[model samples]
Target: MSVGLTQPIWMEMALALLILPGVWCTSWLVLYQDVCAVRGSSVVILCTYHYPETLVNKNLTVEKVMWSHGRKQFFDGPFIIDSNNRTHTATKFEYVGNKVHNCTLQIHQVEQSDSGEYAFRFETNNGGKWTGSNGAKVNISELIISMTTPKVHGPIKEGDCVNLTCMNNCSSAVMWFRNGKPLQEESSTLYLCDISFQDSGNYSCSPKHHNRPLSEVIRVSVEYSPRNTSVSVWPSSEVLEGSDVTLTCSSNANPTLNYTWFKIDGDSCLEMVSQAELQFNVTHTGNSGKYFCVVSNKHGRQNSTILSLKVKDHAEGMAAVTLTILLAVLAVVPMIVIVPMVTWHLVAHRKKTTAPKPDTEENTQTTEVHVTSPTSDCSLTEERREEEPSQQDEVPYATVHITKQRANIQQQNEEATAIYSSIWEQQAKEDLYSVVSRPTPRGKQAQDDPVIYSTVFRQ
Candidate 1:
């Protein structure tokens, strides 16, 4: 019975052997596959092994390794592992780790044409038959790169530091080419040169990797000239009669340049105006509006900022000024003539109202009673009982006054009349063109004399 049981185990082991062929065929197909590499780069090959002898296969050996170029052998070497577990004199195969059986093949500094299929074989035991397998077939490809665009150097002036930079897509080293020629050997982030007429050209660059091609070219044009040339008048927007006006043209160029004036119509080219001091003495309103100027030399050309002119009315402004002066004179004249005459008449009237009357017997008594203000009721009765004085008993008095000053008064009156008459004489003197009824000489005229009279009075 025990033999019967053991016999079934043997049959099952034979069935397992039949499935091993399919598994080994799949593993063999995957071992020798393709390899890929880039130019100016490194490459690595991965290889692993399997054994069916039921041992671990720890002490393995790889011999007669070769790399071929179309049946021509270029590389051949052996991989030897020392007893001390240290490496010595191994060509291309490197032992990575002990857990898995793998031989890694490495190639340094690969090129574009290093692509092809390689073939080799390996044997481990003394009586073991060699197993043949195809090595990797590699396909080489290029790396993509981009170039930076060029920029315009500013403020576009001469004798200034102008710098340029050419950058690559990758971080590798970059080289610059200008006008189809290589630049200097030193590696700098920026290329610098002082700007001048000779600095304009085409520029480009290329990267240091063998996978990339030359970059696209860029053209640079420089405009180095003056700017902000402007023209202005002294008093803007208005030009007065007989006024000295100025037109100034200012720019930023060098070497003491000259300016030329020009005038433009609606659709025509510029026509030259006066080359002198940029200013013109205009007499009428037609000489107003837009004007232009041009500045040029062997280097470049620039046009002046447009300047506009305007004129004002002269005759109307003068007439307004004259009318204002006449109004001021008329307002001030009346106050001069009336103030003194009103003052004299007020003084005479004040003197007449304050004078005292003459004295007499009855009038004196009555005056005495009224003059003493009544202190009590009895005194007030006495003041009323005092008979109102008869006109005869009242002051029948006369006042006679004489003075040489009166003669002075009469003479002043005569002088004032003479002054009024002389006013006519002054008018005649001034208006020599006045019409007259009778002809008269240019000298003095006839006049009258003074008189005295006496009078008597009774009451």
Candidate 2:
């Protein structure tokens, strides 16, 4: 059974040795011969004594019994127990005897200093005293576990044998333990064969007793090859293009080690970097594949399982989405401003060309207009009028009214009485002339900006 250092708790003993006396009488004192006990445990010495009923006038009444263990006197010492003066005795020792025969002594929480011979003494009512000279000897020893192994060439590796011995010359049967748990070993020599990492721990041993005491702890360390090799990837999710990724290799081993990385290319494996970690600045999908790692040391080597990788092309995907967004913007722009603006301009231009207003002269193309700057104005020519007075009186010119009104249509022969026709119809050519306006760079004007016309006719 497994045992731990507690407040002196109980245990399961495989065997028990009962020291019962079959017969006893006619002796003044009876004591145990010799015994062995462990530390932190209680020890009992089976003892008995006899005394006569009477000695002269004093009655042989055994009133007091005392015990001594490796001391000068059983009546006076630090390690003494008295039956009569139980209150004056120290708590470490107890005398469980009666007035008749039993003189058993009990020692609690035994230590190394408690190891020695134990003697018993008795006193009667009349001052009759007797002490047992042949005392029972008690051997005290502390238990511990010690280790021994063959000289290793380098280090104690797997499949090596280790021997663990219960120490301090402990003569009792002991149980071997590792890390507070009991093993199947019972003897003092514990054999560890084909030891591995599982065999490494703090080993101990304890004597087979109900109130057992554990030995001093001894650590056992075992070294072996790389085991449980594994690979870990940074950015554990989907990897993007133009990003950083790292893969790390790890294993359980003793001493120093070396790490090697690999990648599965198509159907074959390719050796990559030779370090504990490998970093890559991913550029394209070409960097996506299955990868693994191998760890090694002076003892042996091991390989890890494959880890899959895939790189996503983020740049190209963003470009395609950007083009789609620009196209959507272009499709909606014409409806918002361009189409409405062009429609407004075309409607304004068509109104200008189709119909002309009747009262406004600037919009009518049929009206003949005469415009002059402020510096050029026509004046009333009284001298020209005086020079052609006779011709002006003989030819009376018709008045022309300027208005923006459409005229009635007429045939050319019906309205042939123009000024040019009248001038060509003149029969007497006696230099007939009248004042006329000159169509040149110079002109005369009245204050009201008026025009005048004159003509000569033969009578």
Candidate 3:
């Protein structure tokens, strides 16, 4: 009975020795539930362990300390931080805790792949191993900013409000940057009230903790109508006639404004053209008046000040008109006088050159013809060789002249009668032969009488 009782006691002692070391070597791990980190940044995972001091005094030494991600079970995931034989294995992971029980792991430039459940495992020199029951959770996110209220992209009108929000999983403060410069405000949301064209630029948001890997850049554009509408005329307002005049319209706007030329009529405006400039040749006074331009865009429209186009002065216009009239009169007066005078001279010259010549022979013959006796019959005759007159012959007319001469003789009856009778008898015999032969009347008797006869001839 003593030998059997001693065997039972030895068996119990052996079992108790195995259970005591296991209870002393037991460890408890404590860590944060979840850690959030940004890409391209570093993270610190703080961890602390608790174990009985009896293991340290029993010559039990820690051989290796390791950290792994992506698995809940021990030794199932790849090791990220490993300190074995007093040396670290991972280049990105570092053990930054005390050598006794703390296992703080620091990761440099943490990436998306480094985020997962991470657990700690430790080994002792006595071939004892322990893995923590709970692991630390890690989360990673990219930095992004977006316009929330507007719900639209760029090209917002001026004086409108804009709202921007920064999207990140980290608990760090959001910083707003305009054109790569930090703004005064710090928050996840940014408000821009009554924005203007100066606010248009590249905008981005980033966490204050991380300096690298900023959010994607967004562009903002402010659209507005033209401001400070101005109109300029070349060569000044006081222009001259027959000169080329140009009117230009200028303004400031976004998305490029469309220009329109207008002329201000009595109470309304007349649209002239759809161009930035209006150019034309000034001919008369009609082109001078009030004019302006309208600049417009999708946002709004603006009109320039009314510009007056004062053409040539009244005196200058009158002078030009008078000069034109004088030139016209000078050109026409000479033609009027010269043409009539030349025509009259030509008519007179033609008449003088075509007059007929007077004939000398016919004129002389008409002047010499005359009647010598009243009781005696006179006969005249003209003799010519040709029937038609020559070119050199002249027109003819007749004229007559008469002259008489008488002689007295005393009567001597007996002796003078006989002498006279013989003279008369001889004259009667000559007259009878000169006269035309004709029979005398039956009752008249022939008597011998004394008579005298006179005859004239012209050549």
TM-score of each: 0.25, 0.50, 0.45
Error of 3 at 361 (Å): 99
Clashing pairs in 1: none
For model 1, the stretches where C-alpha displacement exceeds 4 angstroms are: 1-33, 53-100, 126-132, 143-459
Q: Native-vs-model 3 lDDT?
A: 0.65
lDDT of each: 0.46, 0.65, 0.65
Top-scoring candidate (TM-score): 2
Per residue, candidate 3 scores C-alpha lDDT tens digits across 262-336 of 998888889999999999888887888999999998878999988999789567978878999999999999999
The window of 10 residues in a row where model 1 has the poorest summed lDDT is 363-372
- Give the alpha carbon lDDT tens digit for every residue of 346-456 in model 1: 887888776765542221111111111112323224433354223113322222232234325446435532210111221112211111111121342433322212121
Candidate 3 scores a C-alpha RMSD against the true structure in Å of: 36.7
Backbone clash tally (model 3): 1
Per-residue lDDT of candidate 2, residues 172-227 (tens digit): 57877788888877888998889888888888877765334368888888888898
Report model 2's TM-score to 2 decimal places: 0.50
